[model samples]
Target: MSRHLIYLSILTSLTACAGNSRPAVQQDTTSAITGTDTLNRMVLVPGGTFSMGADDSTGMPDEYPKHSVKVDSFWMDEHEVTNREFAAFVAATGYVTTAEKPISKEELMATLPPGSAEPDSSMLAAGALVFTPPNHAVPFNDVSQWWSFIAGASWQHPEGPGSDIKGRENHPVTQVSWHDAQTYAKWAGKRLPTEAEWEYAARGGLSNQIYPWGSEALTAGKPKANTWNGNFPYKNTHTDGFENTAPVKSYNPNGYQLYDMSGNVWEWVSDLYDARYYAQVENGAANPSGPAKGYDPEDPALEKHVIRGGSYMCSDEYCRGYRVSARMKTTPESGLANLGFRCVRSVTHH
Candidate 1:
């Protein structure tokens, strides 16, 4: 299996949030933007300056060199895009997701090593990665142990041929590539939030906090998010009452009234992934978009986009990506059951 497929599989398998009813985050009326995407249930995120990225002790290098950034106010979805919502976009646009499109020879070879012999065309089929957890514990380095590319899998068939969204209209839609998200956003008159915009809204007016709830303790009396409770892959305690994706708003919203910002599914942002991006903007930037180009040392050949908020597979023992400042990356074409996205619209000035 290719590394791309491997990532999709394991990450998808890892698929699978919070709090009391906090008061609604107040929207700034002084500079109120007009109009609303009533279809998306958007919340107006007040503009503000914030410290972006994370510190050394608790964060990855890509999250280091914590810098300051400012973003203008914008409207963001209160939750991940649900199946019901995405269906409306497709119904209107007849839009086909990347996973629904067959991979061409050129696209396959582009990610492969030079001089590599081409495989049979049959191997290149419309598909998405379905998470197949290993029965036994295995070394984390070789991800192929659990993930496999299922030729028939697409957004409509989350687990491949037999699986369907049947009664999951309220559940967040997964198996959507970044390109697919862009298509949906465009159809809805919105766009993916830039990495900075995402993190800022995710902060929910709190600064330097770990998780969205301002607590590193994954559990305090009751489980905060739908994350793994026991050993990853091999054992899922389901303490949060879910083994996989949960419906949006299954838990409490963040301070910003944003649901599932720290768990449930990994959310794709509009930023290009560059490990050195934080270091480049140490002096602080206003409305800083991500790096112009993408680069990741792990796989320089393939471009990557940033995904945030982690997912259900996130745990204290494994990927603590549930933290607000955590960063992750995958190719734009890589979509899995654990990944989804919300949309944002810039506050237009009259």
Candidate 2:
């Protein structure tokens, strides 16, 4: 199977989108930026110039053409947006998430290959993608071995009907699409971090370092972040004291007091994903917002957005997605079990 299709198969829910509620967040900034989480919950990222993308050959092709870029100071959430937090947003707005809505026949047909037979209506029901680890080792080429689209797998029931966020409210919310994240950001009077802003904040004042905390290998010392520690898909050592998502502050914060910048769940960013975008940025450009439009040659039909911070599923063998300069992309509408996001606000002028 092709690379994009492999991830698309594993990352996407069988088909659908759907609901949310809301609450309040902001508690500072002279009451101007109301409806956002408190400034106490955020850290001010002092902006400066730094090299974006991989400094060496360790990163994937998309992270290539390491170039210098500058960004402005901004307020960033200290940790991934928690389930309790997202719950508040949903409670107040009564908004629906992508996973809870049904998929249109045309939308489902668009993903199928030409001349393919249409799927039955039952197969187009509302759902979300989930990570289902197999009992035995399987080839990585076919991600379907470990992922499946489960009906009713919304953020509230991430793993399906029997699952709930009861004890995991402090954990980052999953099964959230880029659109969902954007909606929450807007309601909170914030926005998703741009790719450049994300990378800059993730670096935490250190340039060219590997992980958010530093160059120390994850397995070299004390547990760093929540990630797969054994054979992926089949076995996990639980070395990080977590089988899946960890509570937001479970790990140490980076230099900027940012938590889970490297692991836990992938974070949605404002930038569109273009495999060749880094090459387009001049080495010394200031505040590049990412490609005007995303173009993934492998999956030209789908529009993809940048997602940062690896997840509990990342490993040394399959992915070092936690690396400071690492990058990945997925469609705006798809939600998964290990993908969530945070918000960043431009400095309030008040």
Candidate 3:
């Protein structure tokens, strides 16, 4: 679909939904080949060795200790899992996302304080975190100021119960938990890309470059990808012509013919996130699949998976996650407005 047409459709849907309701990876080496028609618009990424971490000073601690790693050949979706694509998956399989399933008492208790009483069922309603920007500038340290878990906020109803994905069929599906992504991947006969494979494809054969595109400049000339321009959580210049998610393939593709490798939304990988996993990796590892388990010193209680690329919410003043080497972590069951994913198929060796 054309970008202008998709944008128009989305605007129309947003109005109707509001009026109607109310509210609201991995592998490989030699004999590598690039071929199409293997998957739904798949792009062949002939994997090779590249520096896995960022040496830039802006990199986070977890993205440090740059090392060399190799990946085998694989076919990856050129664009993110769009709302249209996910709809097809659900239509065929009757899948229910984690955001649509009620949170269990056991799950709530796991994260709560000791002896914390389980509240009424009302508190366990199915929901997801929706980004609600504060009216005024607030400290970035407290994320609660802008994020709220709104009931009925799933991929279908992005804003809440009153909202719908009417016009956003082409936009990347958000509010999808990592488990939900895995489920869709399974149904589609594909799997989530490992962190190594993801970075390799995202780099687009550019060794150690800061972004999928050749330039390190976030906004040197025209906006290359969708990202926050003004101060984060306070203002958005919409320099990329999008304040939120854009239609898939709205921008240019990377060297590997993959789109949205940098922004629009954070793409989930199969790897379990561990901040110090890089230090433990054997040098010159081939097709590393990441740590067997997840760990994050910042928040030890939650099990997290690695999310690559960044989202429209990423900003230079705040997140800088849009950088190719930047890394972020979130629990498997937690879904936010800016979290989505793509799928990959491993090349079979004869």
The candidate that achieves the highest TM-score relative to the unseen native structure: 2
Which model is ahead, 1 or 2, in terms of lDDT?
Answer: 2
Task: Please give, for residues 1-350, the per-residue lDDT of candidate 3 as tens digits.
Answer: 11112222222211111001111022233333322122237767886777889847768778879998989988888889888888887887799998888766676666556987866776678887788887688876667666777888999998788999998988999999888899888766678999999988888877667888865588888788888878778788788899889988888877777899988998899999898999999979999999988887755655678888888888776677777888887777776798899998887733
TM-score of 1: 0.89
lDDT of 2: 0.80
Each model's lDDT comes to 0.79, 0.80, 0.77
> Model 3 Cα displacement at 236 (Å)?
1.6
Residue runs of model 2 more than 4 Å from their true location after superposition: 1-31, 34-40, 106-116, 348-350
Per-residue lDDT over 247-273 for candidate 2, one digit per residue giving the tens place of the 0 to 100 score: 988988877878899989989999998
Candidate 3 has its poorest 10 consecutive residues by lDDT at: 15-24
Candidate with more favorable, higher TM-score: 1 or 3:
1
Ranking by lDDT: 2, 1, 3
TM-score of each: 0.89, 0.90, 0.87
Count the clashes in each prediction.
Answer: 5, 28, 8
- In angstroms, the error of model 3 at 278 is 0.7
